[model samples]
Target: MKGQSYSSISFATPSPKQYSETMLHAQQNHATNALRSESKIIPACLPTPNPSSPNFASRFRTDIVQLVETSNIHKHSDTCYKYWNANRGDKKTCRMRMPRKLVSNSTIDPATGDICMRRSDPWINNFNDYLITACRSNMDIKFIWSGSDAKALVYYITDYVTKT
Candidate 1:
């Protein structure tokens, strides 16, 4: 009942329909691909460029892909398995969960009211194309559908803000 009015952005790679829609818009607008430097690296900070330009949609798609590739892909490190304990029979797992389980389609469970956003790539963190493009940085977003989720989010924010 609490989450009924709230909408969520989809997860993982954009669906083929989304990609095709972008392509169609680009074609309709006669947008041409802009040239880029040989280096694939994007600057850490970027100015918010004009979104009204004729090539905005096409350029936006390109920028989103580049930004995600450069920063959003997860790679496991020593810290990932920091909690593992063989003696105690604790299973090896990443504290910051990486390689999330793939969901082929976005769905809301009828009985439980759980939302599963569509996901394709396992190694990529959750991101919104528009948010990542505007901030020019990596981002992680999740829907707070239940009381437990809201509590966890509040705790996380409080802990982060109170940290020295």
Candidate 2:
């Protein structure tokens, strides 16, 4: 049995009917209510800026990093990969370049290290609009959904309104 040739062993492939049924089930699963939930929230993807605003970029990137770092996403590494790629083209190139972190103007509770904001106000939408406008005017924008429903909406609202 040691170093024996086993090339003659036959493999049993699934029959065509079985394969077709599996494919159909997969397709059905792909088109389910859970999958459809993601579509309910609008994608807030915007363009990367042209002649980028250093201030805006710094603030946005820092805020986004903080958000991602703090988020409860299960696969944090994969989320970071998607986010970094969407913002900075590729991981290697971005890592090579120096990044600017945005300063927050919000009152940070020394006790909690949390940047607090009121979630009850209409200004959230305004902030989202501002970010969308800034991205459109300044750079080529790309937004990859974080696989969490409402993440895009939350990012736009929080990043712009609570600008530090």
Question: Top model by TM-score, which number?
Answer: 1
Highest-scoring model, lDDT? 1
TM-score of each: 0.72, 0.16
Report the error of model 1 at residue 120, Å: 0.9
lDDT of 2 by residue, 90-153 (tens): 5442331223232233244666444432222211111232343334222212233333425657
* lDDT, residue 115, candidate 2: 41
Q: lDDT by residue for model 1 over 45-108, one digit each (tens)?
A: 4444467865555656655666776788888999988878889999888887877888888888
Candidate 2 lDDT (Cα, 0 to 1): 0.33
What TM-score number comes out for model 1?
0.72
Residue 122 of candidate 1: its Cα lDDT? 80
